[model samples]
Target: MTRPTALSVALSLSLPLAAHAAPDAAVVPDTTRDIDRVQVTATRTERAVSDVAATVDVIDREQMDRHLVQDLKDLVRYEPGLSVTSSATRFGLNGIRIRGLQGNRVRIQTDGIAMPTSFDIGAFSNANRNFTDLDTLKRVEIVRGPASSLYGSDALGGVVAFVTKDPADYLKDGKDSYVGLKFGYDGQWKGLLGGATGAFGGEHWSGLVNVNHRQGQETVNKGDVRVDNDRRTAPNPQDRDGRSVLAKLVYAPSDTQRFRLTAERNEDTTDTDVLSAISTAVPTPRAPLTSGMKAHDTQDRTRLSLAHEIDALDQPFADSLYWQVYTQNSQTRQQTDEKRTDGSRRHRVFSFDQRAYGLQAQLNKAFTTGSVDHALTYGFEGTRTEIRQKRDGYQVSSTGVVSTTVTPDAFPVRDFPITTTTELGLYAQDEMRLAGGKLSLVPGVRVDRYELKPDVDSIFAQDNPGLAVAQLKKTSVSPKLGMVWRFADQWSLFAGYAHGFRSPPYNDVNIGLTNVAFGYTAIANPDLKPETSDGYELGLRFIAPAAYVSLSGYYNDYKDFIESNVNTGRNAQGLIVFQSQNIADARIYGAEMKAGVEFGELSPALKGWALRSAVAWSRGDNRTDDEPLDSVDPLRGTLGLSYDADAWGVELAGTFVQRKKRLPPPAVQTNPNAPAASVYQPAGYGVLDLMAHWNFAPGATFNVGVFNLADKRYIEWSAITPGLITDRTLSDRFSSPGRTLSASLAVSW
Candidate 1:
């Protein structure tokens, strides 16, 4: 709990609500403008979140129905340096982490399409990037650092854009037609949710449809051993199902042209009994070499899109324009069933697939060059992707013989090959506005080209029998600069510098694996390189009307970075050689602060009270092994208190964590009796949550939440496992989740 005891427990829970909501005499009426929120992923356009200069976060749909949100770790659960990476053993949300980077280096998109690319191979493969479906989101944008100068190549640890729900967002007010319904329940995964939305319009047509479903189990843990080898942590029996569909169509023949068409689908399935991979000790302790396990996992995503928009164009290059053409398909499948105490049987299947086709375009202009006022933005993007992977298995002995030479796997393989990836990007941004606008300047640039091709079939030439599957091409350039200075009248000062890149993927340039009964061999690294970053930010803001404050600082530096597998030793048949390297040089530094207030603007007896707070701190380093970068995450804080009425609202929040003392140093116990490599530090915690909402009439609404409210059993340094140091008694299967409840109800017509 250090870091000054987590910054004095977040300043003793937000300094008495900021000294009892200071704001002395009449001034309130921001009405939660939230710094005039309008975000488009930090500069893909639409700015204003106090004029973006980095660091953005938005989660609308009324904060996902007042926080009854059920996925993406409850949508960032009070977001502090963002996180969402889960894996209670294979397939359970493995994506989204920023600042400490995460799989596929974080870039997820929904409406603008690009999602899928998270693959893990080994204990039966895992491919995840949960593929969006938060009740057909109507907003979610998070851009935190290094957005590859307008998103190119996974943005190198940032970007999460998702925006769906249009049909005029439910044909609002002058409502042509609309319908909505929702229901939900969640008790840490006793889940059940249902949703539907429909809309229709006229004046040149509009249409929308959305559907959702969910069912669940298995997300309970606070371990009570529960038998089953490895001293189980009570969460293995599982069954979860999910479904989603979204559709939209819009057209407007005039008044500045518009056309849109979209379709989406998402599916998720999970079934597991895996009693912690049952075991009874080895061939010596209890005569059991394994017994009973089951698993079935599936994830799917499909999308189709066509979009075009042009507004008031007077073309000198463009007045405004936007375009999209997309097609996407994603899949991940896993099946494993085993039972081997001797009456052997094992079956495995793992597949990861992706297919994409895309085109995107953007253009905008607002010229003036004599007195410096320009707001240009240009774009181009192209994509072609097809990635496929396969791993199949067989073994059925004891008396029913059938085997694909299973002793160390050999049955339909193809860990990498059949890869096709092509990408092209070109970008530009301007935004100048001089003194008359109180100083503002943004500059951006992007140029990217990446290609990788590998076909090599025959099941990857019968599993690495002479390997050589390499072809890659790369080019990149990213740049960014930003500044803002609205000196007074509510003050502001912002600064930024960014550049980020990530290429060299295609399963790490042709990765292949062969295990001679675990003697290990994983080889393929076709001179890989392209993981870079350089970021810097500085900020300060204060917007008043009822109060707002923000403070920030950041630093990032990375190069090559990409370390996977890594052993690189033993060859000549002694096996044990692994690769995938561009060895790592890194750095991360951070700070953040947030504040809000609204004590009825200071009168009317605290008109609807409000207070909010936030804090984050970070540090990471691995300068090529100088240690400590265990995916950095520690020091977090949040505090909230709210009350709103005109139709009810309530909130009480509190999250404070800082107890994962930067890991990575143990490991050096050359068997002095075995067992001593310690790593599992997770001890600081504080949790409290309680949400409420109730519009209850005219278009109904009712939401509820009560998370952790004192049942605290925390642990979420992105679900542990960094520098593992051996199981550590399963760490309660990566804890978190003790007191929980969620409720939702929504209706409209």
Candidate 2:
């Protein structure tokens, strides 16, 4: 089959098909007709989404299948105001930026449990954002703005919530048991993926299980044609494997009460050259030389949770209640061996392990007084986190001479110490239905108490007494208020104001540093203040049987912004080190719009046709630094037209991005051989994508995608930043994947 040009594809809207979204193998899920039907996260209660005052975009299962994302970064491709920083290919430290904030500012929750973050030394990668498997997710929701009223800390920017699949979602009222299997492949990665799912039920009990595995595949990038061709070394090219398994059981002794137990495990491992880049172009007398860099990275996790729920029950003043207790453990280890070409040999090993346990309970009650009906919800959540970081190795001279002092075994070699973090939050929210259900008034408040403590080894204490001292504690109170006014049966106006806060993470406060080779020493800070944010948004929505539209704008003001590093300079070893501190303030603002129309409703002859579009624009100002925020995403827009038939469908989508001209000059250059301090700014571009599906038989389906149909090679701004580099290659940006084809097939009975 031949693909059309980007222009021709962009003009294919009149061709007719499933116009709402891409089809998965020949089927467009019927459930999508109920886009605004129901949601629980918005108000912590099961209610029609149209009644909520917040903006929540739910990526349903069908949509997930269409994207076929292999990692978390791919999930934001078609969405607006969401982008991931690609970092260098070597450490591959990538992160997602929502609106204008990322890192700790954005909270990642899996089934309501907070996930952990990852940070590495030499490679400079944040492996934290790539763990979750798409096969395990039933739906993903992006909630923009500070959600401190509901989730407390790590919610200054917003929240990304992941909900796993449930057997009940695929079961029928009379079905007792069912089994299914699926297999998929992508051209870019050249890999095979397979999974199995099963469910069985009885009068009082039911169970579900899903197991998925991706053997191994290396993601291929577009051919080299960027400003920086190959200045720095990239990670051992993409060889990796991953697996995920989940099991859930539900028991109901009566109609109104039930209990559920769920267990999940995920694992990923990679063995490749950690640092294979070498540049002899620079004058080498003062430069440290290396024979080669090789490493092995392995990350894994296991989680168990038990929950209880009660529906409209025989209670006094309460209507319902929900509670859960969960525990999770995860680890990331990297071992790299290096040989100096100059004659000296340097070897290193590092590991990060975290254990977390938490409890959550929520109570809901509905009552009416006079003209207003009230739905009140109260909840309390707590999490205790323990982290252990270890690093060991010996330094060597530039030449094959003598190996310097070996890394101490008894002393703490980690950037951070043995640490413990505990966070407790108590919150309550009330939804008032007034004016005969034409208006909703929501008021909520949350109180949070947090503490961080660390233990230092004698080796650390003897070298840095002030940095090895003790603990940090903080308390925060957050309030939220929102209102919605219904002017017409199908139109509503809403507005909200919320307060958010974030505390320093363990790594930033106490990354232990003792490098005698280069002569550098860093200490932990026991007294760091929290960062605070105030946000405001106003929006209008129009919903009807044939169409939907939403427009909104938001502004956020932050105080005492906690910058990860305030002072940067070379240590005794000549290695760069940073000390943490707070800045005066910062601000970000943005606007968003979404609209969809069903052409079938306008004309009978155009049945099964529709069109959809979404656009986002945002900007950030780091006032304290007097510069534009590099993390802020550029203006983006997506336009799509689709045709849906009973057993087949096709979709054509186009995404356009505006170039970013706002940027700060490069960092201050210190060492002569070190990378030149400069910024990686990207130019904007547009691309087109094509997808089609066919249901060949009863339970069989076929789907295909012509990615980058125009064969245009574009660069993602997030993927180019060097992220504190020691070498400068002058690469302006990271080029995305080139033209590729992808298809998948599945069957079940």
Q: Give the winner by lDDT.
A: 1
The weakest ten consecutive residues by lDDT in model 2 span 14-23
* Candidate with maximal TM-score: 2
| TM-score versus the correct structure, for each prediction | 0.35, 0.89
Q: How would you encode candidate 1's per-residue C-alpha lDDT over 1-749 as one tens digit per residue? A: 00111212222222100000111111111233556666766776777688988778777777767878778888888889888878775467688888788878888888667788888654567788887888787667788888888778887878888777777756655879888888889999888899888888899988888899999888886877888765687778788998898998888898687788889999889998888767656654333365788889888888898887877778899887878888899988888888878777878788888999988888888889888998888888889999988878888887898987655557788867889899999989898989899889999989999989999888888888897778989999999999988999899899999999999898767888666755666777888989898999999999887888889999999898777657778888898777777878888988988888888887889988888888889999887868788787898988889898888889999999989887767655446997676777878898989998888787888898889888978778888656442666778787877987889888877
lDDT digits (tens) for residues 649-696 of candidate 2: 888988899887776555544467874655555668898989887778
Q: Any idea what lDDT model 2 has? A: 0.71
